[model samples]
Target: MNIGVIIIIVISLISIAGFSRPELIYKYQFNAWQIKNRKEYIRWISHGFFHADWVHLAINMFVLWSFSKAVIYYFMRSLPGNSSIVFLVFFFSAIVASSTFSYFKEKNNYNYNAIGASGAVSAVVFASILYDPFRIIYLYFIPIPGIVLGIGYLVYSRIMSKRNVDNIGHDAHFWGAVYGFVFPILLNPSLLGHFFNELLAIF
Candidate 1:
């Protein structure tokens, strides 16, 4: 878990300086170059690893660390020896999905830019809901059912998107949650525990 977090931190630090050291990594930003270039498409994954400030980085990390291990755990227990591959798939897919959504949505807003793993992190959080829908997420001081929290988050992002908020890719957040919602439902197919029993046999 520490290694997972360290990788995210290093990428964020290298990227966070985009505000101050644009000369070095500007081309790597998730903007025109990402939309235009082909070979450097990995920016879709790389961009999700960094954030703009301490608070931004901290929240992203807390969510990633809090939920990702559980995500990996279930996959590993179910499909032993395949944890790494599944994780890679879930991770990279969320990133690319989020990135593609943002690129198409932001083509005209030249000032639009994003710098957080919230989209991918949102995937992890909502994935947890698929596993445990009744679970509680203390999203705020008040306790809210995790599913409600997830839906609330989507609504908030959608509202923010319509308002044309600056500097935030609300579309990515909404779609990432949408991805998280869809991923396990497609994979597991049932709210019952049957998915786990069969999934484990795959190992």
Candidate 2:
């Protein structure tokens, strides 16, 4: 089975369990106040495996499934022997990286809580975009170039994060997308040149 599919299955099961047993969410959901006060640091990773509802879970899994194969393909090309392990590391690390800002921002807010795989999903998405900038990304049946969508996503996330008007973790999405685009370059600096070449070719 693909690593992405396995992740979807595991996350879905855990999220479903959390739906029936709300205590699971309380224990595992991202609560920066709890981490600061009670030292429950595991929530950084645990929260990604749980989600608020079926729509959240389904959207995350669908995007992840759509992009994981391409990202892994590029990973295999860039770091041949350890692609799978590297992909897993990339996915999980995004969860932590994505939440770092929120942790600091909400450390004192006792009422704040969050749970979802959006960060990791965004990571996979932007990583795929980095690999193929001109690839067509379908949003609600409308096709948009990956580079265009990536820029729009970043702008939207940044604006939304600053507004702080929604329960959605826009900060996580922004950072996760940034991390995804940079990770492969960090591993193999030459990929940065490839990204530029692919991006400019469409012009």
Candidate 3:
């Protein structure tokens, strides 16, 4: 794993501990991580690791692992404008960005707390989509592939978010996915050999 992913895993473990240890977690750890205000938004950056349950951790980390290869592989290639570090900056930044976006918009909701690596994980998955929209990716037991399902989920999240369904942060997930899909194209439109040559030439 890259530094970005390793750091995220470590944070996720710590967040899990904090979430499970209410008294100790709060006392020893910074309270800002629980989705606080501008003064505490720094916590939002690290808050993606904390999960509501074991199931959440398993799913998020599993997806992270599954998709990390494509993202990291794409990022490791050479290109103009520092393509070497493309995925790291985009992945980690998107997580923090997504958290901040989620909190920044819903701060007034009072009950709008956030957690999980879905924001970053979604970025990885959506990045895959941008790379190859027709690629197949199974969701749990389903085998519909990611493009169809990913687009479907994006729309679903937006609709459900508009409806304000339950406690879901659909906006964060959607926007995170959007960032994942966009950053790659914007940074390196070539996306491969020809794209790389043309992009590098511009720089």
Judged by TM-score, which candidate is best? 2
lDDT of each: 0.69, 0.92, 0.67
lDDT of 2 by residue, 51-83 (tens): 898899889999999999888888998864677
- Among all windows of 10 consecutive residues in model 3, the one with the lowest summed lDDT is 24-33
- Comparing 2 and 3 by lDDT, which wins? 2
Q: What are the models' TM-scores?
A: 0.79, 0.97, 0.78
Task: Let me know the TM-score candidate 3 reaches against the reference structure.
Answer: 0.78
lDDT score at residue 84, model 2, on the 0-100 scale = 84
In terms of lDDT, the best-performing candidate is: 2
Decreasing TM-score order of the candidates: 2, 1, 3
C-alpha lDDT of candidate 2 relative to the true structure: 0.92
User: Model 3: runs farther than 4 Å from truth?
Assistant: 1-5, 23-38, 78-85, 192-203
lDDT for position 118 in model 1: 78
* Candidate 3 lDDT over residue span 157-194, tens digit each: 88987898586668778888888877777767666454
